[model samples]
Target: MSSSGTGGSDYDVVISGASLAGSAAAILLARQGARVALLERRSDPEAYKVLCTHSLTACASPVLAELGLIPALEKAGAVRNEGRWYTRWGWIEPWAGPAGAELPYGYNIRRSTLDPLIRARAAQTPGVDLLLGHRVTGLVREAGRAHGVRAQTAEGEREIRARLVVGADGKDSEVAKLAALPVRRHDNGRFGYLAHFRNLPLRDGISHAWFLEPDMAYAFPNDDGVTVVAVLPDKKRLPAFKEDLEGSFSAFLRALPEAPDIDSAERITKITGTVDYPLLSRKPTAPGLALIGDAALTADPLWGVGCGWALQSASWLARAVGPAATGQGDLDASLTAYARTHRRRLRGHQYLAVDYAASRPFNPVERLVFSAAARDASVARHMHLFASRLIGPSRFLSPAALAKAAVVNLKHRRAAAR
Candidate 1:
């Protein structure tokens, strides 16, 4: 429980949100010898995002390991997944190829279970103060430069003066709103429902996701015999679902042939749905302020990209801004670099997610590739790498791969045409 009393310019950085990105920034900066004040709106350490499925793709595994969090996560009972994808055409199992050629994998855990653990770790780190129940009221700017943040806690109003302010407040970020940064938003007319279950059958440590026509469903096994189930459908179907939520969700799950393995599992929590408009962010930085996690960009959750990006963005921001905060470079220059690097690394993934969000059923190109994967083990391995986010779309569209897909598709069409 390392912390400091209010009313001091001793801290170098003041983070507005103390969840994933905020706490991560605090930890990283503090480890770099910068004093930090981490502010969390909720007083309870247990308070966290409940609507998340908490799945991370392979891209973020190294980032977490670099933060020295993998050991803590393992100790907290996180599970590594080899990845499993199920589609109407067929199931794409984990690639059993050479480990070196195979893409590195990621893991899944409950956010409610992971957040408190991270916050606790942040509190233990030297030079970091974990302030709970503190809500940011406004930004403190002088001559268009962020100097600090004004927050209200049970102790009344207080100001944290620091070299920088970090916003990890989530998709609907209050700091982003207050700062008046232009947020680019694209909606897919979709919504997501998530809940947890206990018991029932699932391959140990493997996660399952079903691509059902226009609908998407995922089942993630977490620690303590708990599994998270989520369903995402076009928003137009929400009205009927509202009338009978539980039944609607159950029916939706049952409708997916591949979802039954998860549906047959025990229900430990009531099903819940989120119809909030999914928003994607473009610029995540200001002169002396920066946004991280979903606060920076919220992609279509159908890909389960948020948790991983939160960690990745936090790590990237920490690296980009640490020197500036330490007075080695221009703050604005650092902020610009952070925004550019983030876009460069994440734009491809976001593009793919957005394209898939369109209401159209599987496109012809996707059908051809997936059909080939269903028939050939080599193709399935490639699709596994592509779907797991180990490789980009272009890599999967190489001349040889496309030629193979075309041949496989012709055979399937001939069999059906006959």
Candidate 2:
């Protein structure tokens, strides 16, 4: 690793932001013997991102295992959420275990616990230089290609140069701003609020979500017997929530049919919320720069895909750029591969998530699928696979699955008529 000195071109990659994506990227690159500088604004390793629903879907299991995080997470009491139940048409429970016997279960743990774990692990990696309390001030560009960053640390200003600069900084990324990357944003019409509760009367191993038409609520059983309960209501309902945040929050949860007995649970944290969560998508790469995680794409948080995608995108970026970062391939081609891979894997998912962020009621196709899942065990399993993100949207909406969903719904309708 290169020393943080003036105009020092030290590392192979300078990754901004030491959150999930940044830290994960650092670890992966370092493991491949690429020198990495992982920078974070926060000095404390234990400090974590507070305003997030820190749920990781089954899709991230492999990445977590690769990073060697599962054992530590389990040791810290993180709950293994075997499956999710949706209250769309009715209580739609998928298969009772993991996505498959081979797949590891999804997990729910507070970011307070998760972020620090990832950061610490990354810091321990051999070729990684973890720079805490380093705030990026500007991009160091040469001939229109990003090569490094200008950052302000406690000692003084320093310039760290690299073959590649990764903007894992986040949605409001300084690198993205400096690079002037084209961004496409989608407006979100719903406001989200959540808090942690102790001893919530929910099933121990299952995460539950209620799709109450234009509104949504969830209760995820997490580490230490704490459940994270969140509600996303259309902006039109903001007045009621603002009038009485706790009362309204409780009322909303109680209003969900067959909801958990949240009112009976002990509230452990203050209610926190955000009204502006616009979905953001950006071009993932440029000549010498790449964006990963939320810097590349941010969708509605209601789906709890943020944490999972953060780790997944970092893994994708690492795999795509491994050869180049380790000095065996064309850097530009590797970045282009990463960009294409990012879009191919996440674009469709983001589109659907952003569309739902509009806070509109479910359309005909959603109704058909949800109704079928609620009625048929086989359909429920398929829906679970999609919801868990073990399969892509294309696979979930395949001809065979669609036909089965239609048949399941048709049979239910005919049986009801009788």
Candidate 3:
């Protein structure tokens, strides 16, 4: 809570906003023997953003496994999920085709439960100095290089110096703000309202996503006897939703034919809503500062990929830049490497999420696939795996598979036309 001088605290890395991404980075950097100063604005360690749908796709499992957080996640009572999607045409079964691997998939770990767990683990790690309640108000730039950050504490303002500054401060990142990173924003013309419930007819350990034409809904079974449901609809509908939160939410749930009937289901938490704002990859790194998680890029949450991507990207940033910050490589090269890797790994997925967020009722390719799935069970299974992020998009849309889907769809169309 005190500032000694212009330069201080011989830390290797200073991480702003100690949420999931920041905490994960701190843990990994500390594990690599780098002293990390984690500065969080909130005094309360339990304080966290609650508007998220709280679902982690299987794509992030490998990263979690590598970080040794998988065991901790399981111990914290994460629920395993492998479920079917109810589309307008029919039920799309889980992918078990020749193209997709058969594996038990995914989890619905609530951030309220998972965030504190990861943060606590990060605090216990050897090289991390967790500085709670200190708000990073400015960046310290000397010779056009970020040496550290200036944070306002309870007593006064203090300058914390480090070799590198990592911004895991989420979508509206302050570090990114100070660095003047370029950002491209996309308005998806929709908003989301999410909350938890009890006594909903949720399949045990399985999550369900309903892909309605213009609107969407999802239910994730999580720890503490709670399940999360989010309603994503066009922004024009917000007024009605805002007028009566509970009634609008119930109506939205009932409108989704694929969703389970939750009209009479008891609410576990207050309904939360967020205006639709989709963010793509911004300038992730510059000199000695780098952005991780939503601060770097944020896709549509209809796919439930945000949390997984955050943890995964944080791990990637740590691995890519920690060594350089500790003098293992050129700091610029390390930051560039992290930026490149994050973009390469996530670009395709983000593009796909954006395409889906447009609210167009099934493009031609999707029509063929869904039509095929309605007629052929095998096709539905593959569609299921693809949606779950279990397989790459290329594999899901392979020429051979597309041809098979076309054949099946043609036959169904003829049958219906007759």
Among these predicted structures, which one has the highest lDDT? 2
Ranking by lDDT: 2, 3, 1
lDDT of 1 by residue, 1-418 (tens): 1111122454678898887788888889888877899999999988888888787777778777776788877777777766667776677665655666655677787888788877888899999999999999998887786778999999899988877888888888888888898987777767888888886466545777887768778888887778888888877788898888988888887777645555567798888767865557758888778999998989888877788789889899888878667665677777888999888877777876777777567888888887777766778888866766667767877888899988887887898899
The per-candidate count of clashes, in order, stands at 0, 0, 0
Q: All candidates: CA RMSD in angstroms?
A: 4.0, 3.0, 3.9
Q: Per-residue lDDT for 321-383 in model 3, tens only? A: 776767666778788889898878777777777787777678888878876876786787777
Supply candidate 2's per-residue lDDT for 59. 83
Alpha-carbon TM-score of each model against the true structure: 0.91, 0.95, 0.91
Model 3, residue 227: distance off in Å is 0.8
Q: List the global CA lDDT of all models.
A: 0.79, 0.85, 0.80
Residue 360 in model 1: lDDT = 61
Q: State the local distance difference test value for candidate 3.
A: 0.80
- What TM-score does prediction 1 earn? 0.91
Lowest summed lDDT window (length 10), candidate 3: 1-10
lDDT of 2: 0.85
Off by over 4 Å in 1: 1-10, 98-103, 203-205, 261-264, 393-404, 407-418
**Candidate 1 residue 314 C-alpha distance from true site, Å:** 0.7
Candidate 2 lDDT over residue span 1-418, tens digit each:
1121223458889999999999999999989878999999888988788778779888888999999999999998898766555655677777643555443467899988898889999999999999999999998887788778999999999999888899998889888988999999999989999999998887655788888778888888888889898999999989878998889998888887777887788999999989888999999999888999899998788888888899999999999887687566788888888889889989999889988888988887788888888888778778777777788889888888889999998888899899
